[model samples]
Target: MLLPRIIPVLLHTKEGLIKTENFSNPKYIGDPLNAVRIFNEKKVDELIFLDIEASKLKREPHYELIKKIASECNMPLTYGGGINSVSQIENIIKLGVEKISINSSAISTPELITQAADRFGRQSIVVTIDIKLSGLFRKSYKIFDHKTKTTSNIELLTHLKKIQELGAGEIVINSFDKDGTMLGYDYNLIDYIKPSIKVPLTALGGASKLSDMTNLFKKYGLIGAAAGSIFVFKGKYRAVLIQYPSNKEKKLLYSLPYFIS
Candidate 1:
């Protein structure tokens, strides 16, 4: 079995790294570039930088900051926010981003995914789904920009599968319900979506500690784990440190049986 990956999820709000509860209250932490520098030195598996307000604010990603962060970090970076067109996607690549995670744009013009993956290769694309519970069995998937709300889970899943067939290398699933709460990831969503998509899926949201992470990796047989608030914060879980698991903790996570069921 492949060793599970530990990824740091950074939320960008007007150029600063911040944490939120249920994707609301924003508390400034530090400069994003500074966080990138520190993560680089620590040699984390990968870094995911998401412009939280870009989609809601209806603005393109901050290229200036993207370049600044890219120049300071050596880890593979995945970036998303305010991407709406093929040109915008190309512009982000020009800024030195390794992968682009798109949401609002995908909801607007899904053909764009095929266009991008076809031109840049599947490995360069990552489609992120920020979903929330809708009903007893249904769920809501959002694309951001405030108005980009899509609740057709079937359509959303179809889009993801189509993008993968169009050559998307991977998919990142972020749960809006669990985001920033540090409760734990929405495992049922991950499990439900996993079987339908062919590409590897990375689960994000509601991660608070090493145990939450271990349970996620072990319980779901997930190889990619991403968290934002859990890494940030210290103290009785102060929620500002933004650090990765120590080597020993990782060894413990990796030693779990491949199939927990």
Candidate 2:
């Protein structure tokens, strides 16, 4: 009986940790190291650190910073952005990181997924698919490219299956519109893509509250619930406060009748 994972996503720039709305207007949150130290105290299940500017700037991951974070992180850590080759993945893993997440590079070279998976094992590889709703009258979901900042003609389901077949161990579906919105998870998008994905699946963007996570678990059974804003902000004003559910809260969440055994 697999249990759902509650993960916090930390988006960072070279300057510091930041948060974005609709993938724009990156607001500085705090120091990345400080955030990690706090999450460590809270006993977070897993943590994801994405270099929001690495791929767009055409730079390699800040290995020194990653090494620091990896050394301090007490839980499994996944790092993304500007990861282009197996060497980079190996380097990140050697730094004590648990998983490597690829986005734009994977879009350009799908074979990298298989090669990295073969070299490091699929469990260490995660493929992130950023998606946005397009069109006028009837909006439809399309694959979004963070590097080009454009939607591709590729069908979403086709690409998902392709990534899984290419040996990706996990797939993270991120909503471009719901990013930083904190409204809720994109239930429709999950409904559409869940059936086609054979690998472990995680959903990011639009997770506002604990109920959002509970609703997601009730509906989907077993999946990774990853969020940025919900864990980093507090109160109606959205104050920059790093927090995670306490053990009591988590036990109650897991004890819900809808949660799978």
Which candidate should be chosen as best, given TM-score against the real structure? 2
Best by lDDT: 2
Per-residue alpha-carbon lDDT of model 2 for 1-261, expressed as tens digits?
657889999999978999999999888899999999999999999999999899999998899999999999999999998999999999999999999998887678999999999999999999998999998899889999987888999888889989999999998999999999988888888888888988888999998777778766777754789999999988888899999999899878877654211
Q: Candidate 2 vs. truth: CA RMSD?
A: 2.2
TM-score of every prediction relative to native: 0.87, 0.96
lDDT of 1 by residue, 26-66 (tens): 77889887788778777888889988788777776788888
What's the residue-level lDDT of 13 in candidate 1? 85
> Which window of ten consecutive residues has the lowest lDDT sum in model 1?
141-150
Residue 59 in model 2: shift from native, Å? 0.6
Error of 2 at 155 (Å): 0.9
For candidate 1, the TM-score is 0.87
TM-score of decoy 2: 0.96
